[model samples]
Target: MSTTLVQIQVEEKRFRAHQVIDRLALDIRAGEIVSLVGPSGCGKSTLLRIVAGLETDYAGRVLIKGAKPQLHSPEVGFIFQEPRLLPWLSVADNVGFEAGRGGGKHPRVGELLAEVGLAAFADAWPKQLSGGMAQRAAIARGLFTQPALLLLDEPFSAVDAFTRMRLQDLLLSIAAHHGTTLLLVTHDVDEAVYLSDRVVVMNSGPGRIAGDVVVPLPRPRDRRDPALGRARSEVLTLLNGAQQDYHDIAPDIAAAPPAAAPIDWSKLSFAV
Candidate 1:
């Protein structure tokens, strides 16, 4: 049997007398892409943060490769919701920051820049690049360490629809090419279905895993594919059911329009 890349066992936590994540258990195998979908404040991001070792004040055991999580370890990479790049640093410098001075720059930094189609802006400062470009740089930086696990917290949520689609494709390609295990937290059901091998639905506040469904879609998925639509609907149903009590606070899943038309891939350029 194959070994698991990461595992969370009975992970529980509370903040200010309120439970955040309770009894959350999950296991991700090597090379798998698992997306966590839930309403806002469902502790999806918090759970991810805990797994990434960004937050240690929590209950339960988080095991990475059968050992405790090490946030600063080079084996894990985290991509936050915002690009969070240094305005003073150039693109290459930002991506290679973690390598430290003379840490033997990441051999894949240039390749990653090309993969995200940011080669032309290698010397550009963060403030000079477009929203998409900055986020791409953030992704490149996260991958510079060649982490075994990549944790993304709505990394593309801040971009335009077109840019979001392009970044999604780029992320999928990069993950597959690197054989990196991924745990993504996103509110967009369609986005989760488009990029994930498995969709793990979480219940609102005092969050816990509600459902674990395999996507079963073919690789190189098109956003408008009928299979993707079905998967989105399934996830929507799960989320809808999970939102019963907090109806007024959650997004209107019932009123959401069907998946938008197929994404335009031609506009998305990548060199790697």
Candidate 2:
């Protein structure tokens, strides 16, 4: 049996008086790829932040490898929607930034850059590289520490479709090679189905897990496979149902007044 690499139990997570997440529990096995797909404001990104230890003002316990996740820990890597590369740093430097001074000279930096097909651009500045290239560099950087888990928040959304597909394949290849587990947040259903071993569907209005769809197919997956198509339909169905449920509660929300207490954003150290 696969070991559970991550165990999350969020009894409730509130943003001041507004409850954002309720009764959420999820377990991710080692080396498994899981995708969270839902409507906007469904708390997917928030959940990812919680797992990364970037959002701590919540009621929950998140364990990675049997211990609480630590902020900026080498065991966990994060890739946001944008590449977020520092323009002053070269491709190689950005990849090894976590290693401190002369990071670009790190041997692992060279290996990671080569793995992501950016060895030639080691000396290139972020401003000179294309969007896809920058994201690739981000991936290399995310892997530099050989993290056990990588958290991606719509990491490929900024790229074009063709580039997105290429990056998806590249991600799969690298994940397989490194045996790194992944928890990805994406709006693209096809992308979710193609990349994830399981797709978790969530609903908004105090976000909660609506359902889950398992893509019981082998890797090096054929995008055109009938099984994949079926899985996609299943995900869409769950989303549609969840959407309807959210709409059903719209009238109640419209009638309700604003939250009595609001969080002071500036005071909080963690991202909301």
Candidate 3:
């Protein structure tokens, strides 16, 4: 049996007087790839931050391998939406930034850059690299610590569609090679369904788990597979239902979600 790598029991998480998350419990097994999906301001990012120990103001307990999470712990790596690499630092330096500026000289720096296909740009400045390249560097940096769990918040949303697909594939490959557990927050349903072992749908208005869809499909999933399409439909249904529920209860806070069209399995995509 797989060991649980993360255990979260958040009774309440708030911003000032505004509650953002309430009574949420989740467990992620080692080496699992899980994605949190929901509408904007559903506390997805906040939940990720709490897991990373970046937000301790919340009311909850989060455990990483049965231990309390520490701030900036090497066991936890976080990749933000943007690369956030220092403009003055070289690619190698940025990837090894956790070790300080001299990190560029670290041997693992070279290996990570190579793994992310950025070895040639090791000495390149952040400005010299494109958006996708910068994100690639960020991925390398996130893995520099050889973290057991990696958290990403909309990491690929900044890139173009083609680049996003490539990065997704790269992430899958890296996770397989490194056995790193991933917890991701993404608004894109297709991305969540494709990349996750489980899609955890969150409802807004004090975010709570609305549904959990397990993708039993094997690795190397086909993007066009009808099974994936069905999984995506399930997620969309859950999302819409959650939204509608929120809208009914808090009409002033959230607008109702648009009705989703039925899925056409033969097309392997949502029906228009």
Candidate 4:
């Protein structure tokens, strides 16, 4: 079995007494991909922040690869919802951002650009790139450090649907090739189901773990597979249940759960 790579034991995480995560314990194995899904303000991102050592105003322990993670640990890489490229930096320079943070040089900037299909854009300014291209550059930057783990915060949420799917595939491919552990926060149930080895559902009103489920499908997953649909439903059910519990006191907040849309079996194969 793969050894544990991340251990989170957050006793209390709060924003000036507004609790975010409390008594939330989670373990991620090396090379595992875990997605966090829940209603807004459920502390999913907060949990990632704790793991990455970005937020220290909490009471708890977060161990990455058997030790505490530092801000520039070189063991963690992050990609945010926005590309967050520096305007003055060329595409190639942005990709090397992690190298500078590590206080060393990354000799693979060109190789990394080529890997992300940005070889031609090496000299391009951030303003000249499309949303997708900029995001691709961010992806390259995240992987340039070759960290043992990557944390993504709705990295594809800003892109078009088609572009989102492509980025999801790209992320998985990169993780698999690099054997990098991944923890991501996403609001899309389809995305959570498709990209994660396990989907962790959280509840608001102080942010607690409601469910953790394993994805049963094999790799190179077919987005249109009935199996994927079933898995998606399972995760969605968990999310709805968590939300229902959180909103139990407020009947007006209890939403009518959306019905599952049936897929056209014949048209699925043609779906991009």
Clashes of each: 0, 0, 0, 0
Root-mean-square deviation of Cα positions for candidate 4 versus the true structure, in angstroms: 9.5
List ranges where model 4 is wrong by over 4 Å: 101-106, 249-272
How well does model 4 score by local distance difference test?
0.88
TM-score of each: 0.87, 0.92, 0.93, 0.89
Candidate 2 stretches with Cα past 4 Å from truth are: 252-272
In candidate 4, what are the lDDT values of residues 1-272, reduced to their tens digit? 99999999999998985877879999999999999999898898888888889998898899997899899778899999999999987788889976665221356888878878888998889999999999999988888878999999999999999999998998888898889999999999899989999999998877999988799788899999998788888888898888887778346656567788997787766536
Whole-model lDDT per candidate: 0.86, 0.94, 0.94, 0.88
Cα-lDDT of candidate 3: 0.94
Off by over 4 Å in 1: 102-106, 245-272
Poorest 10 consecutive residues by lDDT, candidate 2: 250-259
Q: State which candidate has the highest TM-score.
A: 3
lDDT of 1: 0.86
lDDT digits (tens) for residues 5-80 of candidate 2: 9999988899889898999999999999999999999899999999999998899899999999899999999999
User: Residue 25 in candidate 4 has what lDDT?
Assistant: 94
Better of 1 and 3 by TM-score: 3
What is candidate 1's lDDT per residue for 50-95, written digit by digit as tens?
A: 8888888887899998888876888899999899998877888899
